[model samples]
Target chain A: MRPLGDDTGPAIEVRGLRKLYGQTVALHDIDFEVSKGEIFAVLGPNGAGKTTTVEILEGFRPREGGTVKVLGEDPFRADEEWRARIGVVLQTTGEFEDLNVREVVRHFARYYPDAQDPDELIERVGLAEKRNARASKLSGGQQRRLDVALGIIGRPEVLFLDEPTTGFDPSSRRDFWQLIRDLATSGTTIVLTTHYLEEAEQLADRVAVIVGGRILDIGVPQTLGGRDTEATVVSWMGPDGLESVHTTAPTKFAADLHARLGGEAPGLTVHRPSLEDVYLQMIGADTAATAALASAAGVTTEDS
Target chain B: MTVLTVAPARRLPRARLRRIASLGLYRGQLELLQFFRGTETVVFSLLFPVFALVIFSSMFDGEIAPGVTYSDYLVPGIIATGLMVTGFQTLAISIAIERDRGGLKRIAATPMPRSAYFIGKVIMVLVTSVVETVVLVAVSVVLYGTHLPGTADAWLTFGWVSLLGVTACALCGIALSSLPRNSRSAPAVVAPFAFVLQFISGAALVFTDLPPWLQWIASAFPLKWMCQGLRSVFLPDSYAAQEAAHSWQLGWVAVALIAWVILGTVLCLATFRWTKTRDGG
Candidate 1:
């Protein structure tokens, strides 16, 4: 991932934002900053206030406390011009089923002063042939592409994508990632919230993980949950069929093996926690530690 | 070949034109698209007043109160009731559906003004009601030999009453839609209440046979006054002689319009939801 620039002002800045639902606390003093022209991903399990935070930023919901500013204006109190600078692609679908793809795009293009031509945007999203087709008739991935087309039509400075590729097939998800990368390259700030670790690893300059309404950690995806710096577990086939070694430094072990043998050790492999594994462990550390004891008794425990 | 070195010229007029067309023609086209796709709504709504007119006219063929033919009295009332059902009731159902499906929330997130959304919908409903009104008028004249308003004044009255009635009902529809939990319950909840208003207050079936309390309640709703005004326009000026007073029904029209304009504004402002998802979730 490219390093996000430090010179640009924060495209989105939030401090101690809170939202309550009667006795239930949906978000408890959440704080984060997204720099301009950077792809910042909010990674979290469901019910962790990701949607709530995004809604508040979009000016659809009022926050209970703290401050939020988008593009130098307080989002909650900002007027339509401020809204024009931001684009949002929500999770819900099939709302504009009656309108054809081109019609829907053209309709939304009216909302902003500086909008791209509807036809060009439709073609860019690879829905040019389906331009005259009703949105409801489009495939799941196509609908998602249309959603992105609608989102970016406004020439928005900041885009909010909430699980944008949730129902997309692999190829479509890759295409969407490339589209996002192109937008980011052209200096559009993007804030993405997704459940897929691969999506975050591939696209995010920085990712923030939230659990139970609080951010557990925020860093580059490869480094998040300390996966990059965490100890590597080296496993190899030995006289006893297989033996494993865990250590902070794997390079020294490799050097020792090179000295012992003429070259690479037989069946030798070194692995650190995968991003998915690291994420699971970070989210369910207590559960994983407790399960380790049960697994020692020759029993496997279910995922948390 | 000579290459001319030229700076990019500003295209302000083209930009402005694009913006205007985007807001107006594009949005208008979308409303038209939704209207065409809604087949079930069209079938049920079209049959409703037509069926009511046919059934009620047949049952009261011999006598419809006094002097006036059953068709004459019934046409105006059915038109008024149809306006209520289509303009107000249908608007409510559409709004509820948009809200439930997250359509309203999506639009709200856009830069489009809330006023634009309302203006587009109201325009769509008014156009539909005008077309339906014309169709009914043509059907009445062809099948039942119904007469059109004689004077310019009568025609003027018809136009004004239709405009005001549609406005009042559409606003009332917006107000009523605010009560439903989701789009699915909208028809189940609105249909029964709407039928009650149509039969009792709309003066559609038996205006004279209804109880005094029911009459008073019906009198308060705009549908009652709208039908009465139409009765005046379609029937001879002497039509009000069957009622308590001659000019009193016209007074009712003015009063109903005022009450609806004021109260309907309050209700719409209070209940309209821009987002279906609850706060914080």
Candidate 2:
């Protein structure tokens, strides 16, 4: 559709974005980009301009001021043909009260020139049997799958999913992730905004944490929140019974302990700062002392 | 991947019509199905005009405007009322619901032209209006021996009234739809003022004997002119003997109807919301 507006362009690019709701500013100079064929996650708490930025990108909300290029075209002024090349799964969509799952998918399929077969999409979303079930009757997770099915039905080059698995249970969330992974493997650029940190860790190739209308940092989950360079807390059984040490190099500590004991270190174990720990630190939390140290060292942050 | 080529159905126009017609038919079926399933909307829409028809005709039977039978005068008025209730009132509720359910939002996100959604809704209302008119006419003929207008002029009047009535109502509906906070609040906002308008200016109240102030209010509204036009079709020439401006006052009737349609259309285009605006800030 419209030649993808220059193949060399990033999947999306936003610069100097600003939005105001009356006297309150919803977004302030927010900027981000998604390279081709990568899963980019926008992480934020509620009221963090996540929805506003995504809505503006989807052309559902007007921008107060910004330059947004989606597939190298200004999304706000893009025509239907441009819309055909991108897919958006909003927070929620209209529930087709009477139509079965298949019918609803089939109906939306007509709006696009190149649409995926509804039956196949239904199966892909793990709702093959429930395809004939009315949308209103489907369980929450199943209904969410239908939302995903509709999003992908256009066979879009870029997909924007807003908390796609927010209400999903553990098993359903996993299944939904696999579906997304499948799409990404086939070269679909995915932009996701979610509240779940673990979800970002599992799905996003690069995650950006946004707060108070600006991005705090962007990196791989392990390296984000200054996770990679942080010291690990090592614990083991000493001659006295038990011992533990917080060290920058757990491997070297274990090696020294082995020489002291003349054998393997007893009950050898190590605890390192998790991605969540580093996240809490960047957003400013008291318990992230290790994360603070990582930040101060300048070794923790990894720019992606 | 296995490649399977399917032949395009390029031979028959009838087959093409059938395929295309099915989409519209499905949408229409969905509309009617939703209408009937909602007990509150159906009861209010169907019963309000019927109650008006029964009460007014009974109260003024054989004495309305001299020679005109109350039932004869009331039937046309009720049909006009039905058009308003079904189109205008229904439009307000439907648009509010669409906003609340994110239907408008969803449609806005799609490649489908935004106008198509409104057009489809108006078409649904038009179909329902036609059916309501037929039902009212049937009941009038069966229960009260009310005659369908005999000549081509009478049919012409019906056509114009139906078209103008629906157009005005739909436009007004779209305009007023933006007033409600959500679907639950829709009735609280729309029903009160709507009933107030009908109560003051509506023809169902036997306006021939009403106070001067009430008559002035009725005269100020387009529904008054619409009802007056409908009455001209059914009531005999002697019925006009009591009208303040006797001989139908066709000029005022035409002007009021045109004014409402134009004003209503402009308002709808200007203010109708396709998506919800967060009210917190």
Candidate 3:
């Protein structure tokens, strides 16, 4: 991966972003920053304010109270010039009924000052064969590919994708991931939200777990919630039967087990928490209890 | 596959007037293409006026007033009704459907100006209205023996009245579309209003003996002025004897239509929404 340019400022920045629907608070006190050229993932359950945050960043919704800066400008007041620099792939694909793939992309291209060739974009999204097919005739995944093609045709500096791979089969999901990776490699900042922890782990340089309209934790995916540095589960056959214990020092425990057995420990195995495990723990219990536990365990829960 | 170079991001200048005009033209062309390709829209917009003419003309054989046969009087009224159906009803329902389906929201999220989108939509509706009018007039002339105005003065009156009437109806349609909660409810809300207006405006039957109160109510809307102005163009000067003012009242027609255009423009701008409220974050 190419190093993020240090001289350039963050691609996105938000502080105290708040949204309200009547009396209900949708997003409360949200804060985060996406570095230039980095893949940032926002992982949350449904109704967790993920879409609200993304929409606010995309300038599709108004913010009740917050300071938001995308590409060093306030998105709420930004004009078309600022909009031209950002691409958004909404959760629901827009209906372009009667328009074929090439025609739809070509039509959207006219809105931008400088847009990629429609034919080239079609090939980039692997829709070359379906270019002549009407939008309504394409399958769900194929329609999503067309959405991505339209999203990137303007060569956006920051691309916001909301649950981009929700309905895709595994193979198509993988192919879509590769397309995103290529865009990231070419220095586009990506901010994505997904219900898939594996997707966040596989794609994001850093991930933030948001629940109940609040950011619970943010860090590198592997070490989020101290999953990488926390205790490991060691399991083996004991004197009577199988035994398992959570320990901070797994290697020492295994060596001691070997010495006691006078040989190789039977069925010996060690496992660390996966990203999903860390994510679940961060968002699972009462917020106060989770915070107390993190403090007790000396795990740093500050945003990275 | 060929490797394409992805350009770096740069700050583009604001859209210039020339670019907006060209883009609006392109969007209009695409809209027209989609409209023509849809079988339902084409048949409803084109054939409905012709059908109305045939059915209404066949039912009335006597002269409506001295020197004005029922067919002659009904031709201009039917043309006015056709304009309302195509300009007002069709535009409103289509915009509602687009909003419900996320198409309008998607375009709004782009860099395109709202004015440009509105312009494109207006142009599409205007073009469709023009086509419907020509076909309906042709059918009236050939089969019903309806005579068009030969003098340039009458033609000029027809030109401005039609232009203003169509613009006002199209704008009102867009404004009224926002009252419906969803696309399904849009037709229910707009169709009844259109039907009542057509009835009161004398599109369905000549209303020479219409109640004064009802006539005042009908004159409040653009459809009434549209029908009256069209009648002035197609009916002989002597036929004006049957009118309420004993004349065509061309001046009042222009005033009422222009006032509607202004009022409708304001209402449309105030109520037009690209996305449904429930869909917003």
Candidate 4:
């Protein structure tokens, strides 16, 4: 890896990025910036333009309109030098026949001017045991591990991973998350899209929700859509049975409950909406808004 | 909680064709490795032509001319058949699978030079063609008692015919790869086309017996001329009476082959894709 110069700028920048297939827009007005070392997660449901957005940035797909810059270079007009700086793990792709884990990694390693040791990379991605196993022989999760190893082999400054850990078991997912963090800790800017909300909450420093070809919200996980500040649900085992209240003042509400019986409030518990909760809420709200706009414009939806 | 810095992007060194050639040569080694590793596919694809030659030569057993055995006439055409199978059939399947199967698109994202890949494919075709040639010719001379070409002129003709034939067929294979909707359907398109071409083009040793329309169809493709060119190398000049033109026509064969190579190049440029979908870029 080369030394980073003293330039203060985001690793990735997108302004008014738009994509279209015929008259239907796949993505529009898409914009965001990812600082170096930040783990930025793009969260969305299926067909929400997540893949389109990432593909445009990865230079695999052309955009209709936008100013997109990755590492101070236009990715759409990307050159070899620009390619050397970025890594991509696209949503599950076909692996090569006859190439074992180590060989494929080493093969990709040669494409870069500076690449991590193939053996060390295999170990890093936790495919050490399967180093000699041919690609066809590996299980799905193992194959994904190989994909991750190949993605980071060049020691890319910015890595784009689209559902990279889809097939992993729980333990492997955790290990993979830790490996992602290790990469970020060393100053690699990471952008990942995944169906797993907990993955975003656990790994992302900041997250964005994209829905219907546009951004629904963007914020740190704790405060995304005010998840941290959303009304908390307070519950306790009351005289009749379990009772509950949704309140912004959970602490005060709990105290009031505590004093009401002049004793312990049995089975008292408090919790707020989680990341998944807020994310689904945002998707739901977006759907309603789009439907309302369509109805007002007298455009009949498919279901309608 | 902390700021981060990353390695700065740098420009590539100047375009050096020598460096590109060496890089391509290295990638070619991996291509060879992958090919040989698929033991069943390699063995079956290369051996089918040799076996076909033996069966047809034995069944058509007799001297077609004064002391000119059928094996003598059959060996060269079979060698051409070997080249077609290795260069056209195998390459089309492999490249289609490699593309739709995800390897090409993955490679596309890297800093690997675009030319290196085609160069690697060329090298792979050359290496495999060599194996097919050695095996087919050895079987012809040692097992069937076929005579070797007696002159350097014959050997020179052999070299150019084999080279041009493989180049043309291999490029056609690549151009045709994107025609398959996906890797799974590659053989569905390639196999029938290759087999049909060989029969009509004289690999079955029946080009003269085919209907005029069929012969004309064979003449339109590179395989017929390739087979005709190879036949000129092994059979005596007097045996040219058996050919449709009653002349060697080696020059026309070369011209036809070079034309196919040019056409194949154009088709490859127009139709090739890194992936199966229209979204492929």
Candidate with the greatest TM-score versus the true structure: 4
Q: Report clash pairs, candidate 3.
A: none
Report every candidate's CA lDDT: 0.77, 0.75, 0.82, 0.82
For model 1 the local lDDT of residue B155 reads 93
**TM-scores, chain B, all models:** 0.88, 0.84, 0.92, 0.92
The alpha-carbon lDDT assigned to residue A261 of candidate 4 equals 85
| Model 3: fraction of the reference interface contacts it also forms | 0.36
lDDT of 1 by residue, B35-103 (tens): 868677776676677878888887777655566776787898899988988888888988888888777
For candidate 4, the per-residue lDDT at A98 reads 82
Give a tens-digit lDDT track for model 1, residues A10-59. Answer: 88899998888777888889888988999999877777777778878877
- How many angstroms is the interface RMSD of candidate 2? 10.2
Give me the displacement of residue B84 in model 1, in angstroms. 1.2
Q: What TM-score would every model get versus the actual structure?
A: 0.88, 0.87, 0.88, 0.90
**Descending-DockQ candidate ranking:** 1, 3, 4, 2
**Alpha carbon lDDT at A14, candidate 2:** 93
lDDT string for model 4 (B1-281, tens) is: 00011123343435546556877998899989988898887888788988898898878878877767777877888899899988899999988988786788788777776778889999999999999999998898898887778999999999999999999999999999988988889999899989888889977765677898999989999999988998888887887888888887999999999999999999988777765564411
Model 2, C-alpha of A224: deviation from truth (Å): 1.2
Deviation (Å) of B169 in candidate 3: 1.4
Chain A TM per prediction: 0.89, 0.88, 0.87, 0.91
Candidate order (lDDT): 4, 3, 1, 2
Ranking by TM-score: 4, 3, 1, 2
lDDT assessment of candidate 2: 0.75
